[model samples]
Target: MENKKALVFGSVLLSGILTFSLYGIGSSIASDDSKHEHDREYEYRDKGTNYSTKSVGTNKLYMEECGSCHMAYPAQLLPTQSWQKVMLGLEDHFGENAELDAESHNSIESYLVQSAARRKGESRKLLRNLGNKTPLRITELPYFIYEHDEIPCRFITGNDKVSSLSQCSACHQNAEKGRFDEDDVVIPGIGRWDD
Candidate 1:
């Protein structure tokens, strides 16, 4: 009877471990699914067009430093190398003295690299048309040009509300939240962006 009881206890413990392991695995998968739900929904609804999947999340240091000057543009918008170039040239950041302390610079660089577009799935297309060129500006990306090709200059550079295409949040209402669904765009002065 003693031996039987011990076996039963061991079996129960093993079962519990298996159950917990499965639960953890399932939770990880579910988390990933929820994270990319926006991407999946957009693809389903749009049929062919695509947008960069937002980063896993944002970094506070990056937001505080870069965002204080310009909208903390989503890091996923650029490739790893591009982000490296941008961070490396902070002293001459678009003709401004945007250099940061070593600690802050390192932190921001890591965040950007981790969040940058890897050459996978739709991200591969993001690097398309660029033959080994590491573009420092998001506006210089080929994909960016292709997407905004339709918008007239008058609506961007000419419009006071939107000084340039760099002001993503100007038209993309949810840009700061890493959501750039074309449907949500509301170009200021102009109503909704049909294109």
Candidate 2:
């Protein structure tokens, strides 16, 4: 009977030690995850201007419906106000009937606003020349114009494959992935464009 009591006590003590050890390890892992999330560029901001490195389309419906027409364009390409305006005027979206039900519209608008570009880095350059202007077209951005300035009108407007600069995927291989590195650009009919 004494031996049995001793064995039971020993087992309880071992169990307690194992539980504490596992708890410590879990806490350490949790701390590391918190640090990683903080360092991530796409951390959600409740109310502030900040750029996000994360790819767009956190909402499936937004990507499927909006992308059905165009590249769906990265939400990071515009500011929160610009996204709001676009959502408000979806019925007349660039002469296209992009009408959406109120629920879907609100959901898409929320996603766009949340994913909108920060007023920093390249995003700042995009809005540089414009003051208090919310351009409906992403191509209207000064940075976009500057980037495409070297390419003659013949290549863009003339090329049947690329009707407009807005057709980002025409030249950018990874436009859908939001990677617009100039090195990857290859005009459809014109072929590779190192410039």
Candidate 3:
């Protein structure tokens, strides 16, 4: 009777351990699924609209001057100081004709400064990808460089729409709206990243 009782007790303990392990595994999987769902919802929210409520000055300058040959560089790509430097050097802007009237230039500068990259918190994907150094040029972004690194350098020069690497909006669909996530990246000729 003692042996039988011991056997029964052992079996009960084993069953309890098995049940607890299964429950733990199941709960972990459920937690992962919930996290994935949350990520999906965040991506959905980012895809809502491309309209910006910020100052129209930058957009105006971009459309009028920069948009003719290539897509406008997103304001968030550079820190305010860099934008200030770029604005100050409009006459010799990256080997192109970026000269503008005094009023228009001031407006553009103001807009760029207001939406500077330095203002981004650590939580922002751009800041995370950028790491330590503040990127002055729009093309200097780690993600942007990584995404375009595979493309032949000649392609940028040959393509009128993407003359320079700075023209992110030329390829990325939601660039103007300040959304640079992996999901939003859609190259003009190239479809999408396999990953």
Candidate 2 root-mean-square deviation in Å: 9.1
TM value for model 1: 0.71
Better candidate number, 1 or 3, judged by lDDT: 1
lDDT (tens digit, per residue) of candidate 3 on 1-195: 999999999999999999999999999999998886556412212211443644654566666666666555566666676688888777777787778888777777777676656433522444546656655576676755775687766557667766776666666566665555566665555566445
Provide TM-scores for the models. Answer: 0.71, 0.68, 0.54
lDDT of 1 by residue, 15-104 (tens): 999999999999999999888775542321211123233322237778899999999887778899999999889999999989999988
lDDT of 2 by residue, 1-195 (tens): 999999999999999999999999999999998986555433223232342323233356777989898887877788788899888888888788899988788778888887777776445556767778888788887777887899988899999999888889888887786667666689987888875
Report the number of backbone clashes for model 1: 0
Best by lDDT: 1
